[model samples]
Target: MTKKHYPLFLLMMLIFGMMQVKAQTSLNDIKAILQSPYFEKLYSNTYYSLLDRMRKDGFLPESLTGAYEGMYCRTTGAMVSLLIETSRLKEAELNIKCVLDATTQNDMERIPHVIGIKDNKYTIISDEHQIDGQAHVLLAWARLALKRGHTNFEDKTWPLVSAIMKRTCDRTFFQHGWWSVEPGLVRNISFEHSREGRRWDVWDLLTQSFVGAALNDMATVAERRSETKLAADWRKKMEILQQGIRKNLTTVRNSDTTYLEMRLPDSNGGTPYLGMGWVTLSPVAAQWEGLNHQVMRNTVKAMQQGMLKKTNGLAWMPTDSYPDGTVSNEIIGKGQAWEMEFARTEKDYNRIKAILDLIKIVNAPKPVYMEGGWLDGNGHKQSEKISDTDLAAMNNAVWKTKDAGNGEQCAWWCWAMARLRVAAGLPAEPARVK
Candidate 1:
């Protein structure tokens, strides 16, 4: 590779270094679970029932109010979105209220990344802030509003949105007219793949895309409420963000362009996302306004060839990796939300089906039910060993590790299935599946 072409080559090298998990699950042998009657009835029914009880009993964790220092809580945005999609409007609204009520002076600090679940009550389990988590919660609010035609709970919901954005006055909330790329983009500066508090200048693709989408959605709310100036400002800022993302995040591979992870101000290269579905979930993948089409397609190609699992082809992406095919993650079902969303957005039927085949409960040969998500393969290098399972046993070995698991109905697994239903022209509700 010559000097001019070495950057893309090196980017590909960084991707190829991701370890391909030896999935224990058989990709071809995935049962016709999506076509089954039990998908909406038996499996999901059982899972959601359990989740509701957990919420009532304080056994489950809420994403917004509960987060740990060393962990990533990705479920809130998706979780809230999933809740709204399932006709659980009241429940979804209650959860939204719990998050909104915390906009006070003392509560604003905890607002960005507070963690915990409300079990008939509210609480905080972790105080660590994750920009993506904040973006997700914001996105969730937007989605819920859109779904509700932007009404019904405006008394509380509107106040919350107004308050959060109003914090731009306070340095703690956002900057005044902080709409420019350099000074305006809210910098949550975080690390992907649980780098254990490693800080990179914010504006990473994952957070950028999510935050950008959220901003646009909020602009819609502003327009509806007749906040014309605010709406216009938001749109203009979103355009600038769009320009910023393209300028900072795009890279070339084999002359095919794609977006890179973090584009630090003085960085030589950008970070690649190996943690399952973050790439596909990028704003580009979401097909949000202002993304480069070639870049998006190239991104899908790069991930499928280099970042995704080569073993079963359906489990998950690597948690961490280098140029030597080393990896440290297993199958995470929720990550599939982006995978399925990307596939649907790209109109790739085959890719969409691959994701659905995994979520189809019956296709899961293992005895486990969906919780967070399940593995298609084992990551021996990625996780610890259990007493019953040998050093490399894959699925049931979860008692000894975190970061990988089954897809529970109330989590990303179920949410992904819902997206698939839309892609397949089926009812979004799994229960209505034929």
Candidate 2:
């Protein structure tokens, strides 16, 4: 590198060095990424109109009182808060109140394990549910209450968070931050391929990452505002969780990109999402926003090739799954569009731009407004829309292209879009795909 390029090279080296430290989750890097104009514009525009569409579709009723709607309590709640963050508080408030009232009615039902059935109330906490589902609910309420200075909401939300954590500790096995649940017997599944002697626990990556993040966010908020008495304890717990995540879920760094673990290290040497990058945005965002920003950035860059865009122009981790060698597979990799966008670093903005351009060209994957929210995929490969509306919405969504013949653009996608738009400083021009 030339003398003039020395600073850039050195900066990259410094970020890599930081990721090697003991506590590897970098909160600061995430914050810096979020602050970038590219992210702001992309996120804001993507999310701005999504809330309006969600409200219109009855997915979010004005009643402010309802049931659990399956394990989607978290997605629903998180979307509401994201909407509010992007200046859609009126809509967000309605959704938040609905969740609160629903949870308040039958607190017992809202625990985890409430999957597949949307009774509008709540479900049971079993092995089937992703832990992050519950965490999302807690985070949604906590963020809203804290931001709005609502003491009562904070009070209510904290207990729920604590209860969930305590229950998680009670039900699952936690040793040195490594958690494993006894499948089938514990819930009901074949634990055919667990760690030999260990319980046949189907470790879901999304839950681990999100649960850790939700706790950390809660802790950070607590430390900042000290809104709840549990802030200190929560913060300590968060530190423990972070340590455990790093220990058990050691980051897989390849070339210049990094990825979190989904399952225990497999010998195949392919990506083991096990749900790792499913919520990659959270930890990365936390690191950037938290004190350890540099660590987060370096960690990402060091592992996964730093978010590559295909020659055909789609932002996704390069894999051999597709005939063209681009599509990200859910079973093998869960190569979704949001991951491509969210994983973009400052060094990889061009790649992100290419992917965004493809999305626009396709016109934003239609069937835009549905009963629940965004549809899951563009190709409808996982077309369980009516049966698994939450899953569909959780995975699908876009800005300009709604009807790409895949499925409806849903809430989770909307949330992703809004966040990206906000980061990019773009106009929040709402477009429909259906």
Candidate 3:
């Protein structure tokens, strides 16, 4: 009741009110950036523009002006996810048909990593049968079916989905719950860090996480469709896979949990740690349910400490740990986008803003372009130039430094931005082409 006590009470109330205001301002600030004209234009240009380049058969090439040819299944699957999330149901359906059409015309039911057109027919370009690619496509199908409210497996995509599940379940190599990446397979080419001619026949965390997630998705679809036995089988496989990941692919030291990039097949093999890059981020990126929250936090902490870098004051995560034991300083566009999504999930507002700033800066000078441009470690663009008309016509998806865009990178970036918008409580749907 004293005047002195009243002053103290009033000051406390003032501090609490200021704290509430600061929290609201933080969220509002994020929303403002996401809703800005610049951000909206970037999303529209990356998305609808890329869709404009899709082939009649639904084949979206890896790059527009770059040296890439054919359709990468994994990339196409990413595009499918983007389309479905944006409510482009018709486009998503056509893309799914493209994937089914590309499936090998054999009993193996194998889906090639790259399917190219030859004589108006789909030909296998790289037949590595990557587990993650398979997972991506299967997950895409499950998502599309679920989104369309198909609860009885009566959708046109059901037959293909069933065949893929059967093939996956029948693979002898996958009998152990988690499959290993075979040595000399072309799948290594898609992995940024493992592309340097490394001999690998080991269990990789990326593959495990993706496959596990896909299994979960498929199981949900099966459960909804009243496929009780199939759902139970898939749930069991997922549990085993999760156990395998935890028992073999994770390590702990000084109370800090670290997920290994790949576990050696044999006991005598060396340590599985690969210096923290995409592989380390995969578990969280896939949102694997088996992962402990503390483990995800530790993995993010490791990436921030080891892989985070800056160029011209813009933040990026450089590609790390080639097979030759050397690190790269190049900013793989897709990798940065993946990290951006992760940052948004973790609510690291500062990290998200830094990445957005980097993207805005790199893409600001949009007229000139190149195919497969070299973005060196120091965040410099090194590639020959093309005209603005060419870029507008092609509307490539991926932008690596100054190189002509690729579909995979563009899809990933757009997907990340879309997620950011949703997080900011803005519209999840991107602006349609005018």
In order, what lDDT does every prediction score? 0.51, 0.42, 0.64
Which sections of candidate 1 miss by over 4 Å?
Answer: 1-32, 37-51, 54-74, 102-106, 109-112, 116-121, 150-152, 166-185, 195-201, 265-277, 284-290, 312-316, 320-325, 356-379, 383-410, 432-434
The deviation in Å at residue 16 for candidate 2 is: 31
Compute the lDDT of residue 324 as modeled in candidate 1. Answer: 45
Higher-scoring candidate on lDDT, 1 or 3: 3
TM-score of 3: 0.79
Q: Model 1: how far is 123 from its true place, Å?
A: 3.6
Residue 405, model 1: lDDT of 29
Which has the greatest lDDT? 3
Clashing pairs for model 3 are 329-377, 370-404, 397-410, 398-406
TM-score rank, highest first?
3, 1, 2
Report the lDDT tens digits of candidate 2 across residue range 184-293.
01111222211121333333334455555556666666665655766666566556555545544445444323334333323222223422333344454222222144
TM-score of each: 0.69, 0.57, 0.79
Error of 3 at 204 (Å): 1.5
Q: What is the clash count of model 1?
A: 16
**Which segments of model 3 are wrong by more than 4 Å?**
1-25, 104-108, 151-155, 169-171, 175-200, 266-271, 321-326, 367-402, 432-434
Report the number of backbone clashes for model 3.
4
In candidate 1, position 34 carries an lDDT of 52
Error of 1 at 68 (Å): 7.4
